[model samples]
Target: MNKPLSILAVYIITAVSADESEPNIEEICRFVAPGTTILRPNTCEQWVRCPTAFGAADYDDGSCVYGLYFNKDTGRCESIENVNCPYESNIVKNRCASKKTGSFLPHPTNCKSYIYCQNGKEINATCPNNLIYHPTKVACVYAKQYECELKTFPANANPICKAIPKNKILADTKDCTKYYKCNKDQQLVKLECAEGQSFDYVSSKCVTQKSAICHPLAPELEPESDVCGNADNVHIGYIADEKSCSHYYICNKRANGRPDRKPLHLKCQNEHFFDINTWSCRDRLRVQCYLDRCEGIENGYVNVAGDCTAYAHCKNGVTIKRGKCGEGFNFDERLQICSQQNISYVACKS
Candidate 1:
């Protein structure tokens, strides 16, 4: 992992001076409570001092001297032979939960962005142009006045990344489904869009093929299939999306939900799946989810997430005719008809 090449020392975030100009301690600090130290993963000597998390900003970073290593168990720097530094698996779960806290959450990987939450509505926002978000200040300030990296990987990198600026996402020249991200270390790493979508450069999102425009050399991908149409399931809770076990969403029902039109989106990491049974993220291998398309198919039959009875006819990507099938039948994709046959809830022939 590319880390700061600095000396080691005691870890103290609270005692550290309140520096409005410093960048966030590190993304790893987000997992710990205020005034605590967590061993920087894959590092032997570097340790991150976590801030109190007030305003979702501010933290201090320190490192163990060249010979000492970070010992998370004791929250101190110890000799390599005396320290047993293992990966803290809870970082992922805690990181996910931490971002959900407070009315405003700092963008974990983006320096100029933050999330604003109010009355159950969540909006991703960015600091105005020419300004950088200062978490402690809780406002946008001059980029020169604040010394912060746009992002950091704490991981590996590629030669291609050296040419790109940090925190920049660019489209892959050869593949519509793939894109590249430049890390804080100026390391370029290729990432993929969710299933059935292509990376949109204009909006910088993975959008449906109907609206997505990929690189000139890339072929077009299929349209996006979704499960956010039913009013009953809308605004209820987060539901697993089709084609990906890890991705889930709390969609706006009709416009995609109520008049509020707010959504909670989450994509589990480290092979985690949105476990419907327990209503949380779980090991993908143990939970079965998003196994078929109908659960989130937006057009024609089976229009809602996990609602087999409802059907929505989406015209020009807008719902026009949507309802349930007759009493004895459910929406069927195979025959594209409402039927009950073969004891499989199959579609009937004319």
Candidate 2:
């Protein structure tokens, strides 16, 4: 199995906290309507029947009998002759065979597992616990440290896309807060507007519900368990992880880009980190993270990094709560209050 990773990245060298790459039952079962059947990462021999309740509880896990493999496309266990499981494995092996020594290759079917090429040898390795093998840092870390470029979809689910042009957002008639878009693949992709906002056709943007147009969502439109699968675009090959300063993955533009290589996760080696300016992992000291908006002060509310109306309540320099002021009110850094006086502050645009 491969280690897991999360999508949220903080630059403070804090503990890794995202779970996207984790093989936990909850993460795997997320985003789809209740009672969906899904595959476990990396293996086609077993499957997990998703539950109606969120997370790990109320789900079923089962495996195929000997000589049979679970076929997600078919939603059943079938004989090896009738499945692509072994063929996919062969592809993985062939990919790693031609890579340079010390190269890491991603397991095509499992986010938690990766292939390591060293000294003219290829080896299958799994990250420890919920940690995922980061190809850039070349180490194992938390989920919040990486994003899976792979988009996932239900194997047997009906297509969610409508007969619309690709890459355009369309308002839903059923739910004012939600909208749909056609992806590169012309799949009906659904998305939600931010809180208190609605998709407005007039302005073609998400705005306050009162000011935006809204329509009810259709009941037939089920949930997209894997948001990435319906995404308009994704980083295709070995790519830098914009979410984490220390992590990177192989999502090369051409998918595999090089036939001798494959998508894999990597992280900077010890005492090294990913430098955004240079766009690669470098010496630790070379990448200094001063992004904490609450860096040194020992308490109370503080203005967020770039928003004047937004503030964070801090305790011992850690943010306990975050909030935004109503329109016309700006955060008063000195008073730790939201006030109307600094509404013209030019620095809030970010």
| Candidate with best lDDT | 2
| RMSD per model, one decimal | 25.7, 27.2
Cα TM-score per model: 0.23, 0.25
Best by TM-score: 2
Q: Write the per-residue lDDT of candidate 2 for residues 184-211, one digit (tens) a residue.
A: 5433456888644667653446786557
Q: What TM value does model 2 have?
A: 0.25
Candidate 1 residues 1-350, lDDT tens each? 12331210111111122221222344323222345555454454566655664224555667877546566556677644344433221122122222333556566557788767554445678998878777677788898888755333233233222212234465555578877665454344568986446787544578866678675545655443345543344345566666566777775434323322334667877545577667787654345443432323355443334455555565543456667777877666456676664323211111
RMSD of 2: 27.2
